[model samples]
Target: MVNDSLPPNQRRFFLTIILGGLSTALAVVAGWPLFRFLSPDTGGADVEIVEIPRASVDVGGAHFLTYRGRPVVVLQKSAGEFAAFSAVCTHLGCIVKWVSDPGEFLCPCHAGRFSTDGAVLGGPPPKPLEPIPVVLAGDLLRIG
Candidate 1:
Protein backbone atom coordinates (compact mmCIF):
# COMPACT_ATOMS: atom_id res chain seq x y z
CA MET A 1 0.00 0.00 0.00
CA VAL A 2 1.18 3.53 -0.73
CA ASN A 3 1.89 5.70 2.29
CA ASP A 4 -0.48 8.73 2.33
CA SER A 5 2.20 10.92 3.90
CA LEU A 6 4.79 10.38 1.14
CA PRO A 7 5.45 12.85 -1.72
CA PRO A 8 3.84 11.98 -5.07
CA ASN A 9 7.18 11.16 -6.71
CA GLN A 10 8.21 8.83 -3.83
CA ARG A 11 4.85 7.04 -3.87
CA ARG A 12 5.04 6.46 -7.58
CA PHE A 13 8.61 5.15 -7.31
CA PHE A 14 7.66 2.70 -4.57
CA LEU A 15 4.66 1.42 -6.51
CA THR A 16 6.81 0.86 -9.61
CA ILE A 17 9.44 -1.03 -7.63
CA ILE A 18 6.87 -3.26 -5.96
CA LEU A 19 5.12 -4.07 -9.26
CA GLY A 20 8.40 -4.83 -10.98
CA GLY A 21 9.50 -7.21 -8.24
CA LEU A 22 6.16 -9.05 -8.21
CA SER A 23 6.16 -9.44 -11.98
CA THR A 24 9.70 -10.79 -11.98
CA ALA A 25 8.78 -13.34 -9.31
CA LEU A 26 5.74 -14.47 -11.25
CA ALA A 27 7.78 -14.81 -14.46
CA VAL A 28 10.27 -17.10 -12.79
CA VAL A 29 7.52 -19.25 -11.30
CA ALA A 30 5.82 -19.63 -14.67
CA GLY A 31 9.06 -20.35 -16.58
CA TRP A 32 10.45 -23.01 -14.25
CA PRO A 33 8.22 -25.82 -15.46
CA LEU A 34 9.16 -25.28 -19.11
CA PHE A 35 12.84 -25.06 -18.22
CA ARG A 36 12.65 -28.36 -16.40
CA PHE A 37 10.94 -30.00 -19.34
CA LEU A 38 13.61 -28.88 -21.81
CA SER A 39 16.50 -29.98 -19.58
CA PRO A 40 18.00 -33.47 -19.99
CA ASP A 41 17.41 -36.16 -17.34
CA THR A 42 20.53 -37.08 -15.38
CA GLY A 43 19.78 -40.65 -14.25
CA GLY A 44 19.42 -44.18 -15.64
CA ALA A 45 21.74 -46.98 -16.75
CA ASP A 46 22.05 -47.90 -20.42
CA VAL A 47 19.83 -50.84 -21.31
CA GLU A 48 20.68 -52.64 -24.52
CA ILE A 49 18.05 -53.86 -26.94
CA VAL A 50 17.31 -53.58 -30.66
CA GLU A 51 15.93 -50.24 -29.52
CA ILE A 52 16.63 -46.60 -30.30
CA PRO A 53 15.40 -43.40 -28.72
CA ARG A 54 12.58 -41.81 -30.70
CA ALA A 55 14.19 -38.40 -30.33
CA SER A 56 17.26 -39.65 -32.16
CA VAL A 57 15.36 -39.27 -35.41
CA ASP A 58 14.26 -35.73 -36.10
CA VAL A 59 11.13 -34.94 -38.12
CA GLY A 60 11.74 -35.88 -41.76
CA GLY A 61 15.09 -37.34 -40.68
CA ALA A 62 16.47 -40.84 -40.95
CA HIS A 63 18.47 -43.14 -38.65
CA PHE A 64 20.81 -45.61 -40.28
CA LEU A 65 22.07 -48.77 -38.60
CA THR A 66 22.81 -52.40 -39.36
CA TYR A 67 19.94 -54.85 -38.92
CA ARG A 68 20.44 -58.57 -39.52
CA GLY A 69 23.82 -57.85 -41.15
CA ARG A 70 22.20 -55.46 -43.62
CA PRO A 71 22.06 -51.66 -43.75
CA VAL A 72 18.68 -50.30 -42.62
CA VAL A 73 17.13 -46.87 -42.19
CA VAL A 74 14.42 -45.61 -39.92
CA LEU A 75 12.53 -42.45 -40.76
CA GLN A 76 10.27 -40.27 -38.68
CA LYS A 77 7.35 -39.32 -40.92
CA SER A 78 5.64 -37.07 -38.43
CA ALA A 79 5.18 -36.65 -34.72
CA GLY A 80 5.25 -40.12 -33.13
CA GLU A 81 4.94 -41.87 -36.52
CA PHE A 82 7.81 -43.88 -37.98
CA ALA A 83 8.76 -46.22 -40.83
CA ALA A 84 11.77 -48.46 -41.49
CA PHE A 85 13.25 -49.52 -44.81
CA SER A 86 16.10 -51.53 -46.12
CA ALA A 87 18.76 -48.97 -47.06
CA VAL A 88 19.84 -50.94 -50.15
CA CYS A 89 18.57 -49.60 -53.44
CA THR A 90 16.24 -51.91 -55.35
CA HIS A 91 17.96 -51.60 -58.72
CA LEU A 92 21.66 -52.09 -57.93
CA GLY A 93 21.75 -52.81 -54.19
CA CYS A 94 23.55 -49.54 -53.55
CA ILE A 95 22.90 -47.62 -50.35
CA VAL A 96 20.30 -44.89 -50.60
CA LYS A 97 20.88 -41.41 -49.20
CA TRP A 98 18.03 -39.42 -47.75
CA VAL A 99 17.42 -36.13 -49.53
CA SER A 100 15.37 -34.18 -47.01
CA ASP A 101 14.90 -31.10 -49.18
CA PRO A 102 13.11 -33.20 -51.78
CA GLY A 103 11.86 -35.56 -49.09
CA GLU A 104 13.06 -38.65 -50.99
CA PHE A 105 15.82 -41.18 -50.83
CA LEU A 106 18.48 -40.97 -53.55
CA CYS A 107 20.74 -43.79 -54.64
CA PRO A 108 24.18 -42.31 -55.10
CA CYS A 109 25.16 -44.84 -57.77
CA HIS A 110 22.15 -44.67 -60.10
CA ALA A 111 20.22 -41.51 -59.28
CA GLY A 112 17.30 -43.66 -58.17
CA ARG A 113 14.71 -41.80 -56.14
CA PHE A 114 12.29 -43.20 -53.60
CA SER A 115 9.58 -41.64 -51.51
CA THR A 116 9.71 -41.69 -47.73
CA ASP A 117 7.22 -44.56 -47.70
CA GLY A 118 9.59 -46.60 -49.92
CA ALA A 119 7.68 -46.02 -53.10
CA VAL A 120 9.71 -45.57 -56.27
CA LEU A 121 9.54 -41.99 -57.41
CA GLY A 122 12.00 -41.88 -60.35
CA GLY A 123 15.25 -43.15 -61.85
CA PRO A 124 16.07 -46.78 -62.79
CA PRO A 125 15.06 -48.42 -59.53
CA PRO A 126 13.07 -51.55 -60.31
CA LYS A 127 10.88 -51.46 -57.20
CA PRO A 128 10.23 -49.77 -53.88
CA LEU A 129 12.61 -50.06 -50.95
CA GLU A 130 11.99 -53.10 -48.75
CA PRO A 131 10.31 -52.40 -45.43
CA ILE A 132 11.15 -53.81 -42.05
CA PRO A 133 8.92 -54.45 -39.05
CA VAL A 134 8.96 -51.68 -36.44
CA VAL A 135 7.18 -51.30 -33.14
CA LEU A 136 6.83 -48.14 -31.13
CA ALA A 137 7.07 -48.68 -27.39
CA GLY A 138 6.85 -45.58 -25.27
CA ASP A 139 10.06 -43.57 -25.88
CA LEU A 140 11.93 -46.27 -27.81
CA LEU A 141 11.59 -47.90 -31.23
CA ARG A 142 11.97 -51.66 -31.34
CA ILE A 143 12.91 -52.80 -34.85
CA GLY A 144 13.29 -56.28 -36.25
Candidate 2:
Protein backbone atom coordinates (compact mmCIF):
# COMPACT_ATOMS: atom_id res chain seq x y z
CA MET A 1 0.00 0.00 0.00
CA VAL A 2 3.08 2.27 -0.19
CA ASN A 3 2.50 5.14 -2.61
CA ASP A 4 4.24 8.07 -4.33
CA SER A 5 2.04 10.38 -2.26
CA LEU A 6 4.68 10.12 0.50
CA PRO A 7 6.97 13.15 0.89
CA PRO A 8 10.18 12.95 -1.17
CA ASN A 9 12.43 13.42 1.84
CA GLN A 10 10.67 10.62 3.79
CA ARG A 11 10.92 8.26 0.85
CA ARG A 12 14.63 8.98 0.35
CA PHE A 13 15.38 8.51 4.04
CA PHE A 14 13.65 5.13 4.12
CA LEU A 15 15.37 4.05 0.90
CA THR A 16 18.76 4.97 2.29
CA ILE A 17 18.16 3.06 5.51
CA ILE A 18 16.98 -0.01 3.64
CA LEU A 19 19.90 0.00 1.20
CA GLY A 20 22.43 0.59 3.94
CA GLY A 21 21.11 -2.32 5.98
CA LEU A 22 21.16 -4.64 3.00
CA SER A 23 24.71 -3.67 2.14
CA THR A 24 25.88 -4.22 5.68
CA ALA A 25 24.27 -7.65 5.80
CA LEU A 26 25.85 -8.62 2.51
CA ALA A 27 29.26 -7.46 3.67
CA VAL A 28 29.08 -9.50 6.84
CA VAL A 29 28.09 -12.59 4.93
CA ALA A 30 30.95 -12.24 2.50
CA GLY A 31 33.64 -11.16 4.94
CA TRP A 32 33.12 -13.71 7.72
CA PRO A 33 34.96 -16.54 5.99
CA LEU A 34 37.86 -14.31 4.96
CA PHE A 35 38.28 -13.08 8.52
CA ARG A 36 38.31 -16.62 9.87
CA PHE A 37 40.78 -17.76 7.23
CA LEU A 38 43.24 -14.96 8.02
CA SER A 39 42.94 -15.11 11.80
CA PRO A 40 45.34 -17.35 13.77
CA ASP A 41 43.89 -20.02 16.00
CA THR A 42 44.08 -18.68 19.53
CA GLY A 43 42.25 -21.46 21.32
CA GLY A 44 44.49 -24.14 22.83
CA ALA A 45 41.94 -26.28 24.60
CA ASP A 46 41.44 -28.50 21.57
CA VAL A 47 45.12 -29.03 20.82
CA GLU A 48 46.48 -32.51 21.47
CA ILE A 49 49.98 -33.85 21.88
CA VAL A 50 51.50 -35.63 18.91
CA GLU A 51 54.35 -38.18 18.98
CA ILE A 52 57.08 -38.79 16.43
CA PRO A 53 59.83 -41.39 16.33
CA ARG A 54 63.25 -40.03 17.19
CA ALA A 55 64.96 -42.17 14.58
CA SER A 56 62.93 -40.68 11.77
CA VAL A 57 64.49 -37.19 11.92
CA ASP A 58 68.24 -37.02 11.40
CA VAL A 59 70.64 -34.67 13.14
CA GLY A 60 70.55 -31.13 11.71
CA GLY A 61 67.37 -32.09 9.89
CA ALA A 62 63.72 -31.09 10.12
CA HIS A 63 60.43 -32.97 9.89
CA PHE A 64 57.24 -31.29 8.74
CA LEU A 65 53.98 -32.45 10.22
CA THR A 66 50.44 -31.25 10.89
CA TYR A 67 49.08 -30.73 14.34
CA ARG A 68 45.42 -29.84 14.78
CA GLY A 69 45.18 -28.74 11.16
CA ARG A 70 48.24 -26.47 11.43
CA PRO A 71 51.74 -27.01 10.06
CA VAL A 72 54.53 -27.83 12.53
CA VAL A 73 58.23 -28.60 12.23
CA VAL A 74 60.32 -30.88 14.38
CA LEU A 75 64.00 -30.02 14.27
CA GLN A 76 66.79 -32.31 15.35
CA LYS A 77 69.49 -29.87 16.32
CA SER A 78 71.98 -32.49 17.52
CA ALA A 79 72.22 -36.10 18.58
CA GLY A 80 69.88 -35.85 21.52
CA GLU A 81 68.34 -32.42 21.36
CA PHE A 82 65.01 -31.80 19.70
CA ALA A 83 62.79 -28.76 19.25
CA ALA A 84 59.38 -28.09 17.74
CA PHE A 85 58.05 -24.92 16.10
CA SER A 86 55.13 -23.76 14.09
CA ALA A 87 56.20 -23.99 10.47
CA VAL A 88 54.20 -20.92 9.45
CA CYS A 89 56.35 -17.83 9.04
CA THR A 90 55.67 -14.89 11.33
CA HIS A 91 55.82 -12.39 8.52
CA LEU A 92 53.10 -13.59 6.19
CA GLY A 93 52.04 -17.14 7.16
CA CYS A 94 54.12 -18.83 4.47
CA ILE A 95 55.56 -22.26 5.24
CA VAL A 96 59.26 -22.22 6.19
CA LYS A 97 61.87 -24.70 5.01
CA TRP A 98 64.80 -26.14 6.93
CA VAL A 99 68.22 -25.25 5.52
CA SER A 100 70.70 -27.65 7.09
CA ASP A 101 74.00 -26.24 5.81
CA PRO A 102 73.40 -22.93 7.54
CA GLY A 103 71.08 -24.36 10.21
CA GLU A 104 68.12 -22.05 9.67
CA PHE A 105 64.58 -21.87 8.30
CA LEU A 106 63.83 -19.98 5.13
CA CYS A 107 60.49 -18.52 4.09
CA PRO A 108 60.28 -18.71 0.35
CA CYS A 109 57.52 -16.15 0.10
CA HIS A 110 59.38 -13.14 1.56
CA ALA A 111 62.90 -14.38 2.32
CA GLY A 112 62.29 -14.37 6.05
CA ARG A 113 64.80 -16.48 7.98
CA PHE A 114 64.65 -18.14 11.39
CA SER A 115 67.26 -19.97 13.38
CA THR A 116 67.03 -23.65 14.25
CA ASP A 117 65.79 -22.70 17.70
CA GLY A 118 62.92 -20.63 16.17
CA ALA A 119 64.61 -17.26 16.65
CA VAL A 120 64.29 -14.64 13.93
CA LEU A 121 67.63 -14.42 12.17
CA GLY A 122 67.21 -12.13 9.18
CA GLY A 123 64.72 -10.79 6.69
CA PRO A 124 61.17 -9.53 7.16
CA PRO A 125 59.87 -11.66 9.99
CA PRO A 126 58.88 -9.42 12.88
CA LYS A 127 59.01 -12.17 15.50
CA PRO A 128 60.47 -15.63 15.99
CA LEU A 129 58.57 -18.75 15.00
CA GLU A 130 56.25 -20.03 17.68
CA PRO A 131 57.82 -22.78 19.81
CA ILE A 132 55.70 -25.78 20.66
CA PRO A 133 55.94 -27.91 23.77
CA VAL A 134 58.40 -30.75 23.22
CA VAL A 135 59.43 -33.68 25.37
CA LEU A 136 61.53 -36.79 24.91
CA ALA A 137 59.68 -40.00 25.61
CA GLY A 138 61.97 -43.03 25.36
CA ASP A 139 63.19 -42.61 21.79
CA LEU A 140 60.07 -40.72 20.81
CA LEU A 141 59.50 -37.01 20.48
CA ARG A 142 56.32 -35.72 22.06
CA ILE A 143 55.07 -32.40 20.64
CA GLY A 144 52.05 -30.27 21.37
Candidate 3:
Protein backbone atom coordinates (compact mmCIF):
# COMPACT_ATOMS: atom_id res chain seq x y z
CA MET A 1 0.00 0.00 0.00
CA VAL A 2 1.14 3.59 -0.61
CA ASN A 3 2.31 5.56 2.38
CA ASP A 4 -0.39 7.70 3.98
CA SER A 5 1.91 10.01 5.92
CA LEU A 6 2.42 12.46 3.08
CA PRO A 7 0.16 15.54 2.43
CA PRO A 8 -2.79 14.96 0.13
CA ASN A 9 -1.38 17.14 -2.66
CA GLN A 10 1.99 15.37 -2.48
CA ARG A 11 0.33 12.01 -2.64
CA ARG A 12 -1.72 13.04 -5.65
CA PHE A 13 1.40 14.36 -7.35
CA PHE A 14 3.22 11.11 -6.76
CA LEU A 15 0.25 9.11 -8.02
CA THR A 16 0.07 11.24 -11.13
CA ILE A 17 3.74 10.69 -11.80
CA ILE A 18 3.35 6.94 -11.36
CA LEU A 19 0.30 6.86 -13.59
CA GLY A 20 2.08 8.83 -16.33
CA GLY A 21 5.08 6.53 -16.14
CA LEU A 22 2.93 3.40 -16.37
CA SER A 23 0.98 4.81 -19.28
CA THR A 24 4.19 5.58 -21.16
CA ALA A 25 5.57 2.14 -20.43
CA LEU A 26 2.40 0.48 -21.59
CA ALA A 27 2.39 2.51 -24.75
CA VAL A 28 5.94 1.46 -25.49
CA VAL A 29 5.28 -2.19 -24.79
CA ALA A 30 2.16 -2.30 -26.90
CA GLY A 31 3.68 -0.34 -29.78
CA TRP A 32 6.98 -2.24 -29.97
CA PRO A 33 5.76 -5.11 -32.13
CA LEU A 34 3.87 -2.83 -34.46
CA PHE A 35 6.88 -0.58 -34.88
CA ARG A 36 9.11 -3.52 -35.64
CA PHE A 37 6.74 -4.90 -38.23
CA LEU A 38 6.40 -1.55 -40.01
CA SER A 39 10.11 -0.74 -39.94
CA PRO A 40 12.43 -1.58 -42.82
CA ASP A 41 14.54 -4.61 -42.04
CA THR A 42 18.07 -3.46 -42.71
CA GLY A 43 19.71 -6.81 -42.04
CA GLY A 44 17.98 -8.71 -44.82
CA ALA A 45 18.35 -8.44 -48.58
CA ASP A 46 16.24 -5.57 -49.93
CA VAL A 47 17.59 -4.89 -53.36
CA GLU A 48 15.02 -5.16 -56.14
CA ILE A 49 17.34 -5.04 -59.13
CA VAL A 50 21.06 -4.94 -59.86
CA GLU A 51 22.51 -3.91 -63.17
CA ILE A 52 25.96 -4.55 -64.62
CA PRO A 53 27.35 -3.39 -67.89
CA ARG A 54 27.69 -6.04 -70.57
CA ALA A 55 31.27 -4.95 -71.27
CA SER A 56 32.22 -5.39 -67.62
CA VAL A 57 32.16 -9.18 -67.98
CA ASP A 58 34.32 -10.30 -70.83
CA VAL A 59 33.78 -13.48 -72.82
CA GLY A 60 35.27 -16.49 -70.97
CA GLY A 61 35.97 -14.28 -67.93
CA ALA A 62 34.15 -13.51 -64.71
CA HIS A 63 32.96 -10.35 -62.97
CA PHE A 64 32.48 -10.47 -59.23
CA LEU A 65 30.11 -8.27 -57.22
CA THR A 66 27.74 -8.23 -54.28
CA TYR A 67 24.21 -9.13 -55.34
CA ARG A 68 21.69 -8.38 -52.56
CA GLY A 69 24.52 -8.69 -50.01
CA ARG A 70 25.70 -12.12 -51.27
CA PRO A 71 28.81 -12.76 -53.28
CA VAL A 72 27.92 -13.32 -56.94
CA VAL A 73 29.95 -13.95 -60.07
CA VAL A 74 28.91 -13.15 -63.61
CA LEU A 75 30.44 -14.71 -66.68
CA GLN A 76 30.00 -14.00 -70.33
CA LYS A 77 29.83 -17.41 -71.98
CA SER A 78 29.66 -16.00 -75.50
CA ALA A 79 29.10 -12.76 -77.34
CA GLY A 80 25.45 -12.56 -76.34
CA GLU A 81 25.14 -15.22 -73.69
CA PHE A 82 25.74 -14.67 -69.98
CA ALA A 83 25.66 -16.71 -66.78
CA ALA A 84 25.52 -15.76 -63.10
CA PHE A 85 25.97 -17.78 -59.92
CA SER A 86 26.26 -17.28 -56.23
CA ALA A 87 29.94 -17.47 -55.33
CA VAL A 88 29.26 -19.08 -51.97
CA CYS A 89 30.40 -22.69 -51.57
CA THR A 90 27.62 -25.17 -50.91
CA HIS A 91 29.64 -27.28 -48.46
CA LEU A 92 31.05 -24.74 -46.00
CA GLY A 93 29.65 -21.33 -47.01
CA CYS A 94 33.04 -20.03 -48.06
CA ILE A 95 33.20 -17.52 -50.90
CA VAL A 96 34.45 -19.28 -54.05
CA LYS A 97 37.29 -17.78 -56.05
CA TRP A 98 37.28 -17.75 -59.80
CA VAL A 99 40.49 -19.06 -61.34
CA SER A 100 40.75 -17.75 -64.85
CA ASP A 101 43.73 -19.97 -65.62
CA PRO A 102 41.83 -23.15 -64.73
CA GLY A 103 38.38 -21.91 -65.75
CA GLU A 104 36.78 -23.01 -62.47
CA PHE A 105 35.62 -21.72 -59.13
CA LEU A 106 37.77 -22.90 -56.22
CA CYS A 107 36.63 -22.97 -52.64
CA PRO A 108 39.85 -22.65 -50.67
CA CYS A 109 38.33 -24.10 -47.50
CA HIS A 110 37.75 -27.61 -48.97
CA ALA A 111 39.14 -27.50 -52.51
CA GLY A 112 35.60 -27.67 -53.88
CA ARG A 113 35.44 -26.92 -57.57
CA PHE A 114 32.53 -25.63 -59.63
CA SER A 115 32.14 -25.19 -63.37
CA THR A 116 31.21 -21.99 -65.16
CA ASP A 117 27.54 -22.94 -64.94
CA GLY A 118 27.80 -23.42 -61.13
CA ALA A 119 27.74 -27.25 -61.34
CA VAL A 120 29.78 -28.98 -58.70
CA LEU A 121 32.80 -30.42 -60.45
CA GLY A 122 34.85 -32.01 -57.69
CA GLY A 123 35.63 -32.14 -53.99
CA PRO A 124 33.40 -31.76 -50.89
CA PRO A 125 30.54 -29.52 -52.02
CA PRO A 126 27.32 -31.56 -52.07
CA LYS A 127 25.48 -29.34 -54.52
CA PRO A 128 26.06 -26.82 -57.26
CA LEU A 129 26.51 -23.15 -56.47
CA GLU A 130 23.14 -21.37 -56.54
CA PRO A 131 22.36 -19.81 -59.88
CA ILE A 132 21.20 -16.17 -59.98
CA PRO A 133 18.75 -14.73 -62.49
CA VAL A 134 20.34 -12.80 -65.33
CA VAL A 135 18.83 -10.92 -68.23
CA LEU A 136 20.44 -8.99 -71.05
CA ALA A 137 18.65 -5.72 -71.68
CA GLY A 138 20.32 -3.54 -74.24
CA ASP A 139 23.87 -2.91 -72.91
CA LEU A 140 23.03 -3.77 -69.33
CA LEU A 141 23.09 -7.22 -67.75
CA ARG A 142 20.23 -7.12 -65.26
CA ILE A 143 20.95 -9.42 -62.31
CA GLY A 144 18.92 -10.41 -59.29
* Candidate topping lDDT: 2
Pairs in steric clash, model 3: none
TM-scores of the candidates in the order shown: 0.65, 0.68, 0.71
- lDDT by residue for model 2 (1-144), tens: 577789999999999999999999999998999899999875554769888899888988999988877899998898889899999999999999998888899999999999888889899999999999888899888998
lDDT by residue for model 1 over 38-96, one digit each (tens)? 88754332322368888889998999987766788999988878999999999989999
Give stretches of model 3 more than 4 Å off: 1-44
Better of 2 and 3 by lDDT: 2
How many steric clashes between backbone atoms does each model show? 0, 0, 0
- Scored by lDDT, model 1 comes in at 0.88
Worst 10 residues of 2 by lDDT: 41-50
Worst 10 residues of 1 by lDDT: 41-50
Ranking by lDDT: 2, 3, 1
- Give the clashing residue pairs of candidate 1, or none: none
Which RMSD does model 3 reach against the true structure? 6.2
lDDT of 2 at 127: 98
Q: Which scores better on TM-score, 1 or 3?
A: 3
Instruction: Tell me the alpha-carbon RMSD of every candidate.
Output: 14.4, 5.7, 6.2
Candidate 1, superposed: residue stretches over 4 Å from native:
1-49
> Tens-digit lDDT track for model 3 on 1-144?
457777899989999999999999999998999899898756437886799889999888889998787889998877888989998999999999889877889999999999988999999999999999999999999998
